[model samples]
Target: MTVMKSVPEAAYGILLRNQCDSALDEAVEQVRNLGYAVLNSGYSDIELQAISDQFDSARERYVDAYGEAKLRSIDEYHSVRSPLTHGGGVFLNLAMNGNLLSVLKKLIPGKFILNQQNCVINPPQENYNQGAWHRDLPYQHFVSTQPIAINALFCVDDFTSENGATFVLPASHKAEAFPSAAYVRKNAVQLEAEAGSFLLLDCMLFHAGGFNRSQSVRRAVNHVYNIPYFKQQINIPNNMQGADLSPEMKEILGFDYMEPASIADYLLTREAKKY
Candidate 1:
């Protein structure tokens, strides 16, 4: 996949409003090219506000449940939202339709996993500074891969330049690994999008959460989707059974009535194979 030469956000909305698959294809291409992309859609102020309340309630529940993690030192490191949510986010998953998941699946194929990541950030007070630059996908994990891995960043709070919005290197997904030691030849950019902007990024791209100079807590949710056969650190383990979903929805969740098969069954025989 290559960087989309044109900005597809406007076209994406136009096409999506019309349910144009062809336009979505173009948008997918565009997302690939840029090495990362952001979709500012399907969210309203009311929606974001509600999500904020959920997070607040979650924090209280987290303290009640985890007990130890509520401590000032321990709670800070709870990047993922599962324990915090008291077993939720999956409901948020259900809110995302299978139609959308199917579209992403077709665009990315057997290379993506759902509900694999989350983040809740609290900036340090009394003059905080930078976070070390890094890529979302580690070096050993990909073992030097070029196919784009995506990390979905959903802003629970408004991502401003003042606050700790994520910064990314556009088109840096081509980089072999996290170029931590190298000096970037160009200026790194901060994604100053508003709340609910789902920032989808290629895992190879170099990025980090910028320093939050604001007083308010800066919260963001990260969902890293990777290619199949790769090691998965986090997974969506929620029970979908009896959930308000159609048969098609379950299929996207890999519940398509699959049977076990041997590796030999999948491979071509030596005699039939063309070397």
Candidate 2:
């Protein structure tokens, strides 16, 4: 892949707003040019504090129920899967935020669905790297005509170089091979942002989390969105069965749309819609 020698000015700390056409355009351009875009102040101070509190409460409960040792045995870092299932109202509201949805709509034209949601907590430790460089998509050495998947990372705490900020190879989304060691050494850049900022990443971009050398912990929530044709990591509709959900929530969760399995079923669906 070809790397941009200079970062686009619009890629740094772009402020996001609901229904702002120019801001949305700039964000899209930056992502296209650099494979990622940073939006500062994605959430308010009150919202960030509430999310942090909720995360703490949830972490305590998880540790109590499963034991800290058990969690660590599963992985080197503390990761909570499907936080939306139990993250309460604050997380639900954040998932459905208008500004976030607007930006996603611009990046992904037509219908999209929530593919995965998880929280990663990287506490200070020696050699604290979580995973090797990888793409969110299961496939490799492939390029899509349009963006098939994207990640929206919400920083629950300030992301700094010492606290394990994400590192990305700019414009690597177009690459058909893994980055060489020398190329990565020269091109990889750390993304540092304040709490409540959003880092929108192209799913194919080669990236990894940096080591946490600081005394403080780093926390982030990753929400991956994909085109509706792809299968979700978790069956959200089945898991959400019997829960009260609004129309918008149902749509975002992919409960309101589906591909027909057969021609007869497709015909039936169209015929039913006519009534």
Using lDDT, give the best candidate's number: 2
Candidate 2 per-residue lDDT, tens place, 157-182, comes to: 88899888999999999878887899
Q: What RMSD does model 1 have? A: 8.5
Clashing pairs in 2: none
lDDT of 1 by residue, 195-218 (tens): 776676766777777777888878
TM-score of each: 0.68, 0.84
